[model samples]
Target: MTTELLTPAEMADLVGVSVDTLRYYERERLISGVGRADNGHRRYDADDVAWIRVLRCLRDTGMTIDQLRHYCDLGEQGVTTKPERLAMLRDHRAKVEARRAEIDRALELIDHKIDIYLNEAAGDAP
Candidate 1:
């Protein structure tokens, strides 16, 4: 099987990020191994796309650039760094869980207020 390659625009579309964001990730070294075409345009292969997806997940989950860079660095070190990577992910997961709990609490409060209004509309008392 052959590996598929994508142009910068195609990559951005496929990854649901702007071309500028792709370029920014490249500049920040959050993702790497983008090839240059004969005309000096950037080309991304399947692996690059996979890495970009990982970067997207990390960014979406509020991972800082430095933390992402560290994670990527550990990933580049091969399976020997699995423990370190797992530790980092565990730490990040805790943060995400905490944030999720806080959002859940706020959502519960909103639902309670909505319930009050709904009950009042139904001619119910406090």
Candidate 2:
């Protein structure tokens, strides 16, 4: 079956981002394969949506625009750049993991405070 091409609004809704953000991604070259309708409206195919999802993941994981641009450039370079792409992703993963650990520690502290509050409210605290 052929995938349905989506309009800009539909794509933005599906991707849980604004149309302006989608345009920004296109302008930044973070996503590719976006088509245009005869009326000059932007159309997105499944492949474009998939690439946008990857861009969202990288952006949400704290990758800078320049870093993402470099990654996109590497991707466009074909199979020969696989090693470099892998290295970049690996490094990014490590950074994400480190941030996760920091968030976990902060959550533990917040939980401890909540427990203390609960104990005080329940008259079980010293």
Candidate 3:
């Protein structure tokens, strides 16, 4: 697919976020401005779209705004923050694992309820 330059709205649509959210991300410095058109409108490329996808992934993984901003700051400085970024990712992974455990417990409870219903229907339980 041709990765053409897109306007803010187009980029927002591609990334599945609102235009306001894209602007907020720009204000927060989570993503860099690609540049501006002659009419002073914001322009973005495929790389910007990819970066927004990363931002969304981080948000989905429960990284708070402060955490994202910190990560972005470190990223701006290049590879010097590799160790710190790894630490942050490890911490986020722990949180994801904990959430997964909670979901598994809930699924187990649901299965138990289903079993109870099935047993009752079979006249195996009063």
Top candidate, metric TM-score: 2
Residue 24's lDDT within candidate 3 is 91
Using TM-score as the yardstick, the better of models 2 and 3 is: 2
- For residues 32-115, could you state the per-residue lDDT of candidate 1 as single tens digits? 778988899998988898889988987898999999988888888899999999999999999999999999999999999999
Model 3 agreement with the true structure over 103-123: per-residue lDDT tens digits: 999999999999989989999
The global C-alpha lDDT for each of the candidates, from Candidate 1 onward, is 0.89, 0.91, 0.88
TM-score of each: 0.85, 0.89, 0.83
How far off is model 2, as Cα RMSD? 2.1
Off by over 4 Å in 2: 122-126
Residue 34 miss distance in model 1 (angstroms):
1.0
Q: After aligning candidate 1 to the native by TM-score, how far in Å is the CA of 61 from where it should be? A: 1.1
The numbered model that scores best in lDDT is 2
Q: Model 1, which residues run further than 4 Å from truth?
A: 77-80, 124-126
